[model samples]
Structures are given as C-alpha cells and as structure tokens.
Target chain A: MSAAPPSPAPRAAVDGETSRRRGLGWLLLVPGMLWLAVFFLFPTIQLFFTSLYDPSGSYEQGYTMTWHVMNYVDAVTDTWNLFVRSFAYAGIATVVCLALSYPLAYAIAFKAGRWKNFLLVLVIAPFFTSFLLRTLAWRTILSDQGPVTSFLQTIAVLPDDGRLLATPVAVIAGLVYNFMPFMTLPLYASLDKVDHRLIEAAGDLYSSPIAGFRRVTFPLSLPGVVSGTLLTFIPACGDYINAELLGTPKQYMVGNRIQSAFLTEHNYPLAASLSLILMAVVVVMVVLYIRRAGTEDLV
Target chain B: MTGSLASRERATAAVPPPPARRPAGRWLADHLVLLLGILVLVYMFVPIGYIFALSFNQPSGRGATAEFESFTWSNWGSVCEPEGLCESLKLSFAVSLTATVLATLLGTLMAFALVRHSFRGRSASNLLIFLPMATPEVVMGSSLLAMFVSLGFDGVLGFVTIVIAHVMFCLSFVVVTVKARLVGMDARLEQAAMDLYANEWQTFRLVTLPLAMPGIVAAALLSFTLSFDDFIVTNFTAGQSVTFPLYVYGAKLKDFPPQLFVVGSAMFLVSFAVVIAAELWRRRRSTWSR
Candidate 1:
C-alpha cells in the first residue's frame, strides 16, 4: 500500500479540490436539513400559532386561528402548580442524578481499571428495557406489600399502613432512577477526557485531594455537568410516564395535564399553549444554564 | 458515541490492581469510590433484576407485577398470550427500522457536510440540528402533532407520523455523534490516499468510509434504540398506532399482565447482547487496522 505513491499534490490543487467538494457538501446536507425544516422548525412555528387558536373551537367544527394570546395565560394559571411540581421534581432528580453519577462516573473514569466498559454499560442497561416497565417496577418496589415499604415500616421510616406508591416520593424516585444514566454517561465522557496527570500535578502543588478536585478536575468536567444536567433535566421535566404510573392525581406534573389535554379532553389550544410554554421555559433555562456553565457547545 | 470510552479504556486497563492487604482506614479510603460505584450500579440494575425475575412469575393474583406468586416458564414461551402485544411490538419494530435507516443515511451525509464544508448557513444548520435534541420529548411531540393537525394530516396520524417524528429526533443525535468522530479523524490518511493516486470516490469508498463506519454504526444503534423505546412523542403522533412503550403503558391500565415483564427482559437482554457483540467486533476491527 505504501509503494503506490505517485506525486505529491500542490497547494493550488488542494484548494481546487476543496472548492470542488463544496457543492457536494450542501448536496449531502439538503436532505437532512430539509427534513429538520419540515419536521422540527416548521412544527415549532406551527405549535406557536396553534397556541393562539380559539379555545372554543372543536375538531368536528375545525379550529380557527383567533390569535388568542390569553391561551398562554390560561395555560399558565390553570396548570401553575403542575408546572412548579414538574420543575421541582425534575430539579431534584437532576441533583440526585448528578450526585449519584459523579462518584460512579469518577470511578469509571479513574478507578474501574479493566471493568470500565462493563461498569459503563451498567449505566445504560436499565434504559434498554421499557421505560414504562422500569417505572412500573418502581410502583411495585414502593407498593405497600413490597420489601422497601416493609423495611421502611419496620425501621419507623414509614408509618404503619402508610404506603409509598401514588406519592410524590415514588414519582421523584422514578425520575431519578430513569434519568440518572443520561447524567452519568455525559459526566463519564468529560471525566474520561480529563488528563490524569493534572490531578497528580495538583497534588504536587500541596493541594489536598478534595481541593485538587474542586480546583481542577471539577472545573474541567463542567461541560459534562452542563450537558448531563440538560439531557436529564429536559426529558425529566417533560416526563409524565413516571408521574402517571407511580403517582396519583395529587402527584401529577404538568406533563400529565398536557397529555390529558391532548388525549382525553381534546383541547388542542390548551395543549398547544402548554407545549409552547414548556418549550419556551426549557429553552430559556438551557440558554441561561449553558451561559452560566460557560460551555456553549454542550450538545 | 463509544469513542470517548474506547480510547480511555485501553489507557486505564493497564493499571495494576491494588495490593490485597492494607490497614482498614487506608483500604476504605482506597476503595471508597469503587464501593460507591458498585452501589450506583446496583441502584441502576435492581429494577432490571426484578423485571427478569418477574418474567417467569405465575400470576395467581391481580396486580401481577406487584407480587410473585410462583415461578413458571410459560410467560417467556408464550409472550403473545396478551392481545395487541405482538401487534404493538411489530409496529414498534417497523417504525424503528424505517426511522433508523433514514436517520443514519441523512445524518451521516449531513455530518460529512458539516465537518468538511463551510457554508453560509452552517452555524444555523448546526443549531437546527441541535434544536430537536434540546427540546423536550413532550414539546417535540405536541408541536409535531400541532403541525400535522394544522396541515390537515391528523386523520393520517399513525405509522407514517411516528416514523417521521422518530427520524427527526434521532437525526440530530446521529449528526452530532458522527460529526464528533469525523472531527477527531486525521485528514492525513485521506491525503495519503490521494497522494497514492487514488481518486476521491475511491478514497472515500476504501478509506474514509471505513474510518467513519464505527460512528455511523453507533449512531444507527442509538437511533433504533431511541425510536423503539420512545413513548412521549410516539404517544402524541401515534393516533391509532401502539408502539412497544405505548403497549406497555396500555397494559398498566389493564390487568398489568405478567407477559410484559418477559418482553422487558427480552429487550434488555437483546440490546445488551447487541452492544457486547458490537464492542467485540469493533475491537477486532481496530486490531486489524493497527
């Protein structure tokens, strides 16, 4: 293979070659970009408009574009508690995920030795099963007859005859369990890329282990933190399956409401408005989050 | 996607294990992270273990998933006992297969373009690719449904819409994963091929494509898994269609059948096997390349 060399191409030839490939590049891009334009960009614009439709319209009669901006207001006021609960639960789940994953990701990155791949696979293995099934597994685990409940009861953690299912605690547990992998993988990616010598260098400078981590390793891994949090927080914030399967109505998040509005009540305006509001809030939160994390390319 | 892990694993695998005997305090300190890791892994795996166990459970009582009455091999053998379960699985497979192919093709091409060519709207195009991933599943679902309804396609919302939605979401991830691999690629190899008088297409077919194959395969795997496991967007866009997640969710509203656990365990086992196979294959290929 090494014996087949002809002559080295000149610089002008390389430039010409690059220019020649430019048209083909966009040719390659158009199909995917067009798909996004149709499926992503257009739908977002469509959702924004649908959010402004008249709330009084129905499917049989066909909805009119009344530009009802109050749909957003009504959506907010009607489901304010759901919104708060959703963010609060997702926020807590994100924090818990970060905590649980940090040590595990750190171990995988710096300590697992030959078992790194095996351990990392464990992070995403649960997700290979049905998301609903895993959440339902929580339902069983937290049920009154389950071992967790019995143990908690015996230890005086839960009251006698008191249950865990249909509670906010169960719902939050599901969120944390389901999304923790999303947090762990990204954190592992960033942590794995960190130069091991940097930590040793910090130790040579007389900084303690905790101080070295805080002053060096942690800062470099903020990209993972930002990305991991965003990935976990976004879907966790929008998730209704955990809340629906493990939670009663009292524990329902905005996702439950939005879902019901679309599926059961057939209130397109309300659902669209709710969806738009969720998107807007998530985008704003992500932008501010990335800004604070100071890693613009977290994706 | 596995690129980050692949490079690090070999580097860390050579480190020698700690000595067997040590003081209690020192041992605890040295293995603290390891214990924490094992605990975290257990937390992640306990549910899967329960599901696998329940796959063989004989449901003598209601709330089948809630209690394990007796062990039976019937459920795994006859997973189709529950109505609509197999049908939903078929639909999910169809959607996932179609979406994965389209997504991998489009995303791989887009990745090559984004990495190799600087265009007028490349930055904006990158943002557009990132938008689908940044948006929550529920929002993405509802927005797509809203667009479908507005465009008078609500009556037709089923498999086609599900495929579209799946591809749309999966495409961005495919682009990013492949683009990362492409960006990390050394262009000198391709230039060396060119210097050896190989033409552009020949170079791509023989050298460039092989280099990008791992990333492409990873993206395709990711797309299929995402599409198959998807619930939120699939729920919104699938009017009369029921994918696997939807089927599982629907079962919860019913008798909460035991057969579903079989399905869950099967999914985990199959995907884990595929992952292991792919990893092994990649290792052999890498060795051959070196």
Candidate 2:
C-alpha cells in the first residue's frame, strides 16, 4: 500500500482505444453528471438567488427577485458575532484536535508495528455510532452532577459551582472529540511515509532528537498537518449539533442560527445568505490553506 | 544513552557495529506517543461505553436516562418498545437503501469513466464532484431546501426529498472511493483477458468487475451508513418525515429512552462486526494467495 503504482502507465497503454472508449466514458459519465448538475449545482444556484430575495416577503406571500444585496450585509451585521464565534470555536477545536491527534498518528505510524491496522480501526470505531448520540452522552458526562465535573471540582480545576456543560469549552471539546479522526487519518497517511532512516541520519549528524524532529520530521509531516487542519476546521465551523446539544444559546454558532432561521423561523433569505457566506469563507480558507501547503492533489 | 553513544562512536569511527540498547529516557519518549494515543483512543470510546452500558439500564423515570436505576436485559429484548422508534428505523433503512443504491450505481459508472477514459471538462467534473463534500451540511441542506421551495415541492417534502438529499451527498463519496479502486487496478488483468480471445464485455465481467468489487462494496456500505446517520440534511428536507436520528433527536426533547441507546449500540455492533469480518477475510485471502 505504501508505494502505489503511478496512474499514467495504464493510460498510456489505453491511449489507442480512445474512439470507442470515449463514447462509453461519456455515456457512463452522463447519469452522475446530470444528477449532480440538477440536484447539487442547480440547488446551489437557487440558493444564491434565494439569498437575494426580498427579506420582507414571506414564503406564503412569495419572495421576489429584488437582488437585495443587503441580505448579505444584514446577515453579516446580524450574525457577525455568531459567524466570528463559529470560526473561533472551530479554529480552537482544530488546534486542539491537532495537538491530540498528531502524537497518536505518529505513534501508530512509527511505533504500533504489528497493531497498526487494529489501532487505526480503533480510531474510526467510535464513529460507527451516531454523532448526535455521542454528543448527548457528553451532556451527561459534563452535566453538573456528572463524574467529570465533580472530579474537576474536587481537583480544584473548577470552582465549586463552575460547570462545563453549557460553555464554549464544552462545545469546543465536542468538536475536538468529533473531528479527531479526520485529523489523525491524514496525519497517519503522510507520517507513514516518513523514512525512519532520515531521523537516524539526522541523529548521526550530531543533531539532538528533538532538533531532528523539529527540523526534519515535522517539516516532512507538514502536508498532513495542513490537510488535517483544513478537514477538521471546515466541518467544525459548520457543525451545530455540539452547540445545540452541549451548549446554551449563548454558545450557539452560525449553524444553530442558520438552522433555526430556515427550519423554525421560515426566514429563507437569511438562512440562504448565511449558508452562502459560510461556504464562501470555508472555500477561501481551504484554497488559501492548500496553496500554502503547496499541494495540488488535495481533491 | 548507550545506544546513541555507540551510534555516535560508529559515526565518528566510520565503522558499522551491532546497535546498542536505547536509554531509558529514549525508550520512554518512544512509548510516550503510544501511551498518549491509547489514552486518546480510550477518550473516544467513553461515549460509546456510555451508549453500550445505558442500553442495558432500566431508567426509573422518563426524560432521557442520565443515571442507571438498574441493570436489565429488557431493552435489548424489546428494542422497538419506544413508539415511532421502529417506524423511524424502518424509514431510515428504506431511505438509506434507496440512496445507497442510486449513489453507488451512478458513482461507480462515473468512476469508471474518469479513471479509464479521458474526457473533456475532466477537471471541471472533478471539481463538481468535490463541491458537495467540501460544503458544510447546513449549507447543502439549506440549498436543497431552497431549491425545493422554489420548485413548489415544499408541500411535498418527505421520503422522496430525504432520499434525494441523501443521494446527492453520498454520490461524491461513492465516486471517490470507487475511483481510487479503479485507478489502482492493474490494467494488465483486463488486457490479458482480452488477449485471451475474450470480448470487451467478457473481459469486464470476468476480470474488471471482480477486481473492483471490494471498492464498490465499500462505497455502498459508506453510502448506506452516511444516509442512515444523516440528520442535518434530512432535517431540512424531511418535513414531517422522521428518520432514526431525527427520532433520537425528537426523543431527546420528550423522553430519552434507553431503547434509543439500544438502537445506537446495535448499529455500532453490527457495523463493527461487518468491518472486523471483512478485515479478517481480507487477511485470510492475502495469506491464502501467498
């Protein structure tokens, strides 16, 4: 698995079959492409248009295509705090996930030896259960009378009345717990390819182990770090389940707001605008991050 | 210390020798990540443990059992005791099945096309495939809902809308998984079949399909799990429909039944068994071939 054969070899061999294969290829591609274009792309365009609909018009009253750009401006103004808080919470969770996952990934990549596959499976095992159920369990774990909070209080890590359940800390913890696998898998994939000999060579050249890791190992693993952060951060930013289940309205992020707006309040324009803004921001961050990571094969 | 010293000596003396034992500190450092990794793994399973343990608990009062009143085998015996739970579970199964089949069929074809044949707009198609995966669930859900509302399907949101949403999101994942398998396949197998006086259809049926079966199956499983587990996208388009997760969420508001925990536990165990069996079978196959 470590050294996959390059993809171009078979392409070169099949280059002569173009005329017949091309028609087959197009035929094969049509159904999926048409589905995506109709459902995904067309919906996205509708969403954009919906974002610009007249905010005063109710769903029953029928929204007009006024191209009301202030919906974007008003979305930013109204939910700017929530938007900023979303990115902030997701950013911190990404960092925390990185901190927790990097060592684990490194261990599995280099040290697990015979148990590598088992450990990797273990990493993904928790995900088989519903994420919502898992978050709900965290509510029990972090509840006022729960063991975790009680232990924290006993250890003086918390004030006697201080609780984790309804705070940003809980929300962030949920995000970290939920997205850790995303961070670890890519890190392991990249770290698995790091040659042990290079670290040994660094040691042999009189560099200390820590220095060797800092200068060599970490740099070699930067691609994983970049991809892992992006993967963790992007979904984390849009996640509302954690906030909804584990936190109060005070800790609610943009997702919670957008969800309520669309589903409960029937505020289509606001929800649409918020959705588009979040997508725009996420795309920008991901592209900038991938570019900085200097990888062209991210897809 | 001694291992490093010996390596240092060898480095300076330009002579290779048997490696020395690592120092205690280095050994600790080497194991530290493993220990930490184990701890992190344990942390991940805490909630799962809660789910499993709570499944057997007899809650004294209603409103989502936080404390275990007593241990009982009743929840497992009557897993569908909760009203609407079984119905929601059945709905989830139906929707996920429909979505998985549609997504897998469409995606596998696209995967073959992308991997085996060059096409115009290939890069654009790739980007199109990736857009859904990159976009957040909230955004995707809202967009689909917006599209449905605009098309006057708002009143008719239910099973059909849920399946459409599930298929749309699951398609990209299926394509990616199957495409990886197709790309990694040895073209020689198919070529050799053709060389052996086999027609194109015969070559595909005999060689290509068999080799790609694992990936297709994997993609199907992934699609099924994703659709079954989906809540956000379904919540938007489902309207009055209740999938399993939606049932659980609604139960959270009214009465968090221990039976829900049973369902969660069962889902986990079933999927876990499938994965483990697949892994063991794969290992056995490799050894047998060798």
User: Model 1: which docking level applies?
Assistant: acceptable
Per-residue lDDT for B108-127 in model 2, tens only?
99988888877677777888
Model 2 chain A lDDT-worst window of ten: A1-10
* Model 1 spans with C-alpha error above 4 angstroms: A1-19, B1-27, B285-290
DockQ scores for all predicted structures: 0.41, 0.47
Alpha carbon deviation, residue B90, candidate 2 (Å): 1.0
* Model 2 docking tier (incorrect/acceptable/medium/high): acceptable
Candidate 2 yields a Cα-based lDDT of: 0.87
| Model 1 complex DockQ against the native | 0.41
Model 1, B110-196: lDDT tens digits are 988887776567667877887787788888888888788778897899999999999999998999889878877888999899999
| CA deviation > 4 Å runs, candidate 2 | A1-16, A197-200, A203-207, B1-25
Position A6, candidate 2: lDDT: 29
Task: Please give the distance, in angstroms, between residue B257's alpha carbon in candidate 1 and its true position after superposition.
Answer: 2.0
Q: Per candidate, chain B TM-score? A: 0.88, 0.89
Write one digit per residue (lDDT tens) for candidate 1, span A1-299: 01011212222347776676777878999999999999999988888887898999996686899899999999999999999999999999999889999999998998988778877777788899988888888888888899999999999999998889988889989999988878998899999999989987755554446656877799889989988998999999899989888888999988888888887888988998998888888888987887776676665
